[model samples]
Target: MAFRPAQYAALLLGALTLSACARSPAENPQERSVIQNEDPFVAAMDEATNAAAAADRSARKTPSKPQQSDAPRVDTTAPKLSPAELRQRILRLTAGLQSAADTEAERVSRFLGVSFTPELMSIREGESIGDLEQVGSYRVSVSRIDRTAPGKHVRISFGPAGFSTGRPSICTFELAEFADALRSQGYDAGEVHLPHREQWGFVRYVSASDLTFYVSAELYRANDGTRSGKLCLADVTADAVKGRQ
Candidate 1:
């Protein structure tokens, strides 16, 4: 009933060939990429890579905020200065000396360090300049019509407070101290009375040669409610008292 040796050997050879043919393409290394595309592990990795690429593209397309400049901001608006402080700054900056040169342009420029243009056609009263020049927030004029034993009477006047863009008022009594300040600086300054308008006027420096300084202005109101005037700081050469001679 048993098979012969030759027959058994032939059966074994056939079985081996069938077993080799039965193996799937997935089991072969050359066909592994085809299988990997369908594998859950490979599919997850591809999905992660695509998601990362999409996020990168979206980030690139989104707009970013603009950067600000590092430069400092400048304030061109003028500031109001107290009368006393204004006087001090002017005197200190010029060292209480003003140039008396005939070159009016150079004189003003040296005093203020700012350029100015005067209306030469406006000069009046024999060397008294009625021309108004803008010095920041105030108007300025120079005069030397009166010459005295001390020298030429140089008068620099400043117009009122509306120059700095505010309604700043001043008490008339405060000017007395400023007059005293001039006297302290070796100026023959004195207060003069003007009853009709409540004017507290002062004449400073009989001989400054010629002084240049900014005069701050303040609005002063009278009791009548109808009268208002500007209180100002002026640098001048005093004229001789009338009737004294």
Candidate 2:
């Protein structure tokens, strides 16, 4: 199918409509013709999606001040060092990923389980990239903040049913497995609760230096009764995660 964000929004809206009884096909030929013609509902959704896309584009285009860092830059072109020191430097530099160099192209292809171009992706200050991805029956969205800074953050979320029921599919298990992978990478992992209204699925939070991660099931419900339980993860700098006083 075409990579139409409007269509995707429409399908999501369709799920909500599907939850309730749809109009009977035998209602009338006129009703069928109306359905075949332009749908006001779908058009509204398309407009909303387009507005959001434009806003995102504008945000990315508006330049932001460069990040200020207190830590010294890593010596990638360093003199020879002992094995232990070299490993330590590697860990520090990648405390949360030291760089994100993708810009120019509004869209780029990268592997995050499945190979797909990021149509709804944002790269800001040439330092961070954030995007939402739909992988088969799953939806994955992630953000890596402050790449060039010594202490950056990466957030990832994996959800089942990117295009179907709100209930989780096979991707539920993948959520936990991905958390395990983070643990294997030496992150401090734990489960955390979201606000009361958002407490609908599994949620895990991980922290490592400048990076903090959140893994949880999607907890979005459409007013029309469409529900979803997609897994999601987020890794971010501590400062970014912190609230302003």
Candidate 3:
């Protein structure tokens, strides 16, 4: 798994993807032959926003009794949290160390009764470490404190699990509403790295100050016609600001 931006389909994580030296299959043991032999992490992200259906198959088999614990839990994906609240939560999830940082990730882990592996899992290429856990509705992939560059960063991505069958726990977020929420909180309008459809019509990638979110054009069209969608993939990294507009 060579750590490079061109390798990934989208605008790869600014410093996380391409900064590291070339890597090997040993570095990505969990790697699987996916669409276009594309990186599973990236593919997982692209597929997150997709509402299309998959081939009918047998359901996934999970442990009967998984990580059971009496811990307070919260699903940040749920639309319940105000975008402003979710912003703070994104900060909380990536705040400390691994599971020890244990704010949102721990809540998700505890709620699903699935604990992160003791050993760090290589995610989104390079050695940007984190955990991989799957439960009933969603697949959870998160990066540990990103030490590759200087910043408080966490890359989190969630997609509907293969076994999922329209689970209510899945967060169904409308892009416009969520974006507006962040904007109201003083976040910028967003910098488009890759715009789909037309010029600023819809964006595949957008960054605001220290925050960046990637989505498809279907969420909001050129005429500002918004659609019903949820945030399937998101990379939340809090880094230094290059001054403000």
Alpha carbon deviation, residue 183, candidate 1 (Å): 1.8
Q: Give the lDDT ranking, best first.
A: 1, 3, 2
lDDT tens digits, residues 1-245, model 3?
12222322243344435546443333343543443156665556546534233322222343356657876633334333333344344433333222223323445444333344422344321111222232222223334334543222233333324313332333323345645644444344343334341111111112333322222211221122235333332233333212121
Q: In order, how many clashes per candidate?
A: 0, 19, 0
Error of 2 at 170 (Å): 3.4
Best by lDDT: 1
Report the lDDT tens digits of candidate 1 across residue range 1-245: 22133432332334335335432346666566666676777556657878999999998999976768665533322234444444554444224333334224345334433333433444321222222223233223333332322222223334344423432343222455565665465444223332232222222222344332212222243133234443444432222221111
Instruction: Kindly provide the TM-score of model 1 when superposed on the true structure, using C-alpha atoms.
Output: 0.34
lDDT values for all models: 0.37, 0.33, 0.33
Model 2 C-alpha lDDT per residue in residues 1-245, reported as the tens digit of each score: 11233332332344335335333443677765566466666446557878999999998999987789776543222133332232232233223331232111111112121222333345321222222232222222223343442322222232324323443333223335444554555444443333332321211122333322222222333223235444432221121221111
**TM-score leader:** 1
Clashing pairs in 3: none
Give the TM-scores of the predictions, in the order they appear: 0.34, 0.28, 0.33
